[model samples]
Target: MKRLAALGWPALGVVTLVLLWVGAALYMGKPHVLPGPWAVAETMFSMRGPLVVAAAKSLSRVGVGWLAAAAVALPAGWAMGAVPALDRELRALLSLLRPIPPFVWLPLLLLWVGIGEPSSWMVCFVAALFPILAHARQGVAETPVALAAAAENLGATGLHLWARVRVPAALPLTFTGLKAGWSLAWMSVVAAELVGADGGLGQLILDSRNLARPDLAMSGMAVLGAVAAVTGGLLGWAERRVAE
Candidate 1:
């Protein structure tokens, strides 16, 4: 019953949104400018094949970038968090970089890596890196000193102390960072693809615009939103399990 209520609320919200969208489209009386929900849905179904291929490509880029970011950021963040000296040295640099949007790197990446898969992956990596790194540092910094002392007294030192005491304590916050990083990575990959790409949902949207097909463009956006929502829901469920 509780689960039904949880699902019902969001379903209601989506229905309400669709109605509003349809109404707005009717008021405009121009399908080209703002296609109604039905038109978008039709376009989505019609382009399923191309959409699937594009979505797969985008997901692949996100997956590769996210994993790479996790590998580099987690260790670097842990090291910085564990050592005050290292944290102090890097804090200012990180602060400067954090505010810069991932999309801003597009032109530079294009220049450096050329207009290809590598550039897209690089942008996604940058997007995912900061949040993960920040959270990891915070998680480690917030670990109880008493816990570390206890482990040390028990002959836990160096890597063993970090592995058994620090990391376990910080897992929850680390997971939070991972979730945030993934969201950023997803967004970044889409933007990267939109700007310059041979294939992906973003590229599909761009192509739709060029072809004067607003319905198709909206369909691509809907697909992107749906995919992000599903992935986020799964991540949230996993996060809850980890917390429990």
Candidate 2:
């Protein structure tokens, strides 16, 4: 009974949304421009194989870029956060570069790397890097001085201090940043693939558009949204589990 009760709101919300969507699609009365849910579902069913492959490609790109971002960000963020002088030195440069939107780099990347997997990877890398670094830096910098002092008194020093005390303390904020960074990476990959890759959900959408199939375009978008939702749900679950 309790388990069923817990599921009530989510089920209700989903049903409400589906109703609203169906209402809108019916009102629009033009399947080409505003494909109904049924039409989109049919399209998705027909193209499941291609859609799954495209999703896998997109996920692979995101994994590559996100991992690279984390590799660069965690250490750099820790260093910047731990050392006031280093933070001051790089903050200005970070300021200058961080404001530039991810897609703005697309043109330069296109020129340098051309439209390919490399361009897509680079775009995802750029998109994921900044948030993780910013969050990580903030997390480390804000680690309580008392906590570090306690660790130092107990014989912890330098890397050990950071590893044992600061990093663990900073986990919450770092996790926040990591989650945000991965989302950015996912979005960037789609944007990159739209113009840069011959495969992936973005390319699927592009092809669907060129082929005058709104249903297929919606199907691609549906898959993208589903993946994002599932990833986010998993992250939330993990975070909650860790907290517990």
TM-score of each: 0.94, 0.93
Candidate 1 positional error at 185, Å: 1.3
Writing each residue's lDDT as its tens digit, candidate 1 over 1-244 gives 9999999999999999998998999999999999899998888898999998988899899989999999999999988999999999999999999999999999999999999899999998999999999999999999999999999999999889988999988888899999999999999888899887789998998898899999989888888888888888888899888667
Candidate 2 residue lDDT tens string, 5-41: 8899889998998899899999999898988889989
- In angstroms, give how far residue 218 of model 2 lies from its true place: 0.9
Task: For candidate 2, report its TM-score.
Answer: 0.93
**Which residue pairs show collisions in model 1?**
none
> Which residue pairs show collisions in model 2?
none
